[model samples]
Target: MSLKIEIHSFSYKKGGIPKDNSGNGGGFAFDCRGILNPGRVEEYKTQTGCDIGVQDYLETKTEMPKFLELVKSITSINIENYLDRGFENLQINFGCTGGQHRSVYAAEKTAEFIREKYPQATVFLQHDEQPQLNSSLINDR
Candidate 1:
């Protein structure tokens, strides 16, 4: 069986978490507002986490690594169980004030991590604020 991880990044102040058809909550929501924001700096204000400079700043200046580790540990367990139960969909969300900086970075990295760690699963990544970049999918299997 193949598992699918749908990762989303959005602005908390804008719409909060995305709701399902039944109006129930969906997935994990990691608030990245507390993390060091590169957006506050003028140099990185327009830049997204996809930039090397922004990525370096976040990895070095913030506790993002530690946060990601915890995310991985928790999600890994759930993923294993989901796979065992033949579940097809899993959604994880990352949110920040702007949804352009920390949340985007975290969502991207988490999707990458999940894809690499679970080669049998497929990972889908989306940035709500920056739809121009288009969504990406990792077919690990």
Candidate 2:
């Protein structure tokens, strides 16, 4: 099946501090920091050595474990019903207080999770209120 997913990659301006209790699969809190300030490219590269945000927040456990679970649940639902599915399209949305900071970072991490678990599937990133890329995705033409 032609699988497709939409994953929004955001920065720090819209999404406020992310919370863990957003779903029923409640788990321990962990900060999956997705910080990559281009201003300090050299330093950041030296600190982590990996370009992907996944390597940056190499913490013991992620604070937003529920986010990961949420994604897993989606995949599980589809896989359970094998041939029944035609084209799998999942939009794992991550909404912090705004749409930046933790939410954006979490979204990135979530994308990685989905890719690893559900390979050979399409993924897309959609930020609701991205202050960085202001291209007017909300306007009437």
Candidate 3:
């Protein structure tokens, strides 16, 4: 039995909290603004979170690992319960000023973590600003 998790990354300035059609109404939202931004650096300014250097900067310079740990703890509990109850959708959103760096990083990491931690679950990742890397572990709804 596979559970479904929908992870989204967006810019707060461009899109507000994504509307939940999963009957849950709302879901978790994490702001990436507090983390040190690679966007401010000249070399990393044009790069997205997918870049190795940007990912390294976030991992080495910011508290992203600790933050993801907290996220994992919360989502693990919720995902287990959701699976038990046969729930279909769990939405987790990450937001930042530009949605290109910090939020994108967080969302990608979270999706990867969820897929790794819950192999039976289906994870869909959507990046609003960078749709090129957007992917789905399951077919579109």
Candidate 4:
């Protein structure tokens, strides 16, 4: 069976939490508001989490690394179990104030992590506030 993981980044103020279209009904939703927002800074205001400066600010100035670590740990267990059981879909959502910085970074990092650690799973990444950045990477293992 093929396993597909959907990772979404959304804005709490704009779009709110992303809906799971996987039909599984239950999944993980991570709130990124506690972390320091790079958007608050003048230079990072125009940049999304996809930019190097925003990523650097999130990594160095915020607790995002630790938060992502925890998220990785929790999600890893579920991913492994889902793969073992031959599950088809898993949805994970990350939400921040604007969905451009912290949530986007978190979702991107989590997709990367899942792709690296679970080569058997296909990953679909979406930035709800930035539809142009959406992509799907199918890992045919």
Candidate 5:
């Protein structure tokens, strides 16, 4: 068989990073805000928690007009590497203020994007709201 792509969606919540919350080193701990949009990330500084504009970090952000460019640069490279090497599965994250709104929407959109971009690959989303990581894509890991 060739390769098959899967799309897993999870609600993303804004936070520093996900820990098992334990100091062990088992779960995920990636900071999506700062990583996806570097210089533009300061927009969150004044806000105490979860600014909705984060979704538009791409459509907005005048100075760094390439929000998707930055996101893809950080994520796609890693995704492609796994695929090129013939990995069976991969999981990716897209975090927003709350798992309810922007993050959820973006996660769905991202899953769609990945499915279309890499038809042969399996794309999955693990938003912050997920009680556990990779509830669906867990097997891939």
Candidate 6:
């Protein structure tokens, strides 16, 4: 059996949390609001996490790296277990104030991490606030 991981970036203020459409009840929801928000800055207000400026701000000025390291550590174990147990679906969510900067960056990085580490799992990435960036990555091992 193949494992399908659904990762979403959303806003706590706007959408609350993303639902687990996979019918698995739900999964991990990591709050990115604690890490410094780039949305508060004027220069980065217009840019989403997909942009370099916001990405830089989250990477350097904030504790996002450490936060993500923890998230990765927690998720990696579950991914391995899911794969081992032949699970069908897993959902991971990242939420921030605006769902633009911190959450987006974290979601993107987490998706990349999963793709690189668990090549056998299929990943569905969605930016709830920025739908244009939505994509599905199918990695068959």
The sequence of per-residue lDDT tens digits that candidate 2 reaches over residues 46-109 is: 3221234423442223444554565567655753353256555444455443344455555556
Query: Which predicted model would earn the best lDDT?
Result: 6
How many clashes in each structure? Answer: 0, 15, 0, 0, 4, 0
Q: Give the winner by lDDT: 2 or 4.
A: 4
Q: Could you tell me every candidate's TM-score relative to the true structure?
A: 0.90, 0.47, 0.91, 0.94, 0.47, 0.94
For model 4, residues 27-128, the per-residue Cα lDDT tens digits are 899999999999999999989988999999999989999999999999999999999999999999999999999999999899889999988888888899
Cα lDDT listed for each candidate: 0.83, 0.45, 0.85, 0.90, 0.45, 0.91
**Lowest lDDT 10-residue stretch of candidate 6:** 132-141
lDDT of model 3 at residue 26? 71
Pairs that collide in candidate 1 are: none
Q: lDDT at 43 for candidate 6?
A: 99
All candidates: CA RMSD in angstroms? 2.4, 9.3, 2.5, 2.1, 8.1, 2.1
Candidate 1, position 123, lDDT: 83
- Candidate 5, residue 73: Cα displacement in angstroms equals 2.3
Q: lDDT of model 4 at residue 119?
A: 83
Query: Model 5 over residues 20-80: C-alpha lDDT tens digits?
Result: 3223333222223433442235755432112457445534543223543564566677567
* Regions of model 3 farther than 4 Å from truth: 136-141
- Model 4 — TM-score against the truth? 0.94
Which residue pairs of candidate 3 clash?
none
Off by over 4 Å in 6: 136-141
Provide the global lDDT of candidate 6 against the true structure.
0.91
lDDT of 6 by residue, 23-134 (tens): 8899999999999999899999989999999999989999999999999999999999999999999999999998989999999999989999988888888899998777
